[model samples]
Target: MPTHHEDELDYTPTPHNVTRARTRTAHLAAAWGHPALAPDVALVTSELTTNAILHGSLRGRLIRVRLAVVDTTLRLEVSDPRAERVPHPREASPAEQFGRGLALVGALCDDWGHGPRDGVGKTVWAEWKLPG
Candidate 1:
């Protein structure tokens, strides 16, 4: 299927770049004719990139963010250089600030999952259905 709108970016994994990713996701969503999805897209972007920065990043490796709109679906993917450290969503206790990122992604997107990338690393993706 042909893509309607798409963008890919590579960023050095850092705490600052997570905000950049979120802003970019929101901008892309609005430009793609899905303004209402901007917030959710941005939230998902933040969650995924933050997780990558905290858990999957390697020294001198870049994190990749890809956002695309195809047919009636909007998808966002975050790639990091760690295949072994996979993500699993679990309930978080009130005192814990972490452990809720994956859960939030799952709740916000229609579907979300992670898998190995080309050679080294993994790609975690989330998708939402757009208005038809």
Candidate 2:
């Protein structure tokens, strides 16, 4: 079995950091020999990090993103500072500009969930099964 591979980013909850997080996720995925999954992984990263910035943000707290390859799965996790702002997929109006991030995550990833982090807040994670 391949050794587990991991990478991480810690950033302030700024709008610009969402793009930065997406780019890093793509780079990590490609470096792990899963370039074909880069686009989808980037999309998921963008959605999750955007949520972290918008909903899970706490003053003076930073968001953390982790990317890992374990066995044949690619996993992405975003940790934020608000534990109460749990995420779920919900119906959105066609005219709505937001509210669809988790829906997109659900559509793209094989599995996704959220739970309390080691300390103050929560972490949202999604995983995709890698092709042989």
Candidate 3:
């Protein structure tokens, strides 16, 4: 039986923190009998964290990560303190500077979306189907 509580994993926005996030996700997946969901969750986490570090205000704000499993579906959300810059899927040329994170998220997860977080910043989320 999975615990039904509002669990949240929050951490600083550092490169090493990304690995920590991955490990945490792995543990959560294993506990919920959804080890296969770890990789996709890790990928999404990486993309979101990287975006926060590169484009958002990372002075003293910590990146908030929340993971939950409900009805055989795993929902992952990464929130940062920057609402001015919203993520959008866009076309990129072969020689483009940078632009392909959200695209990868769309391809990996069963469903993904982004929205404002309490009028402060945006939370990019993705969900994966758990194995039976």
Candidate 1: tens digits of C-alpha lDDT, residues 1-132: 889889999999999999999999999999988899999999999999999999999999999999999889999999999999999888999999778888889999999999998879999999999888
Model 3 misses residue 97 by how many Å? 5.9
Tens-place lDDT per residue, model 2, 1-132, is 664899987999999999999999999999989999899999999999999999999889999999999889999999998999999789999999878889899998999999999998999999999886
RMSD of 2: 1.4
**Residue by residue across 10-94, what tens digits does model 3's lDDT show?**
7888888888887787677667677677777778878877776677655888778888877677888888889887788887888
Q: In model 2, which residue pairs have backbone atoms overlapping below 3 Å?
A: none
Q: Which stretches of candidate 3 lie over 4 Å from their true place?
A: 1-6
Give lDDT per model, in order: 0.94, 0.94, 0.78
Error of 1 at 23 (Å): 0.3
TM-score ranking of the models: 1, 2, 3
Instruction: Report how far off residue 46 is in candidate 3 (Å).
Output: 1.0
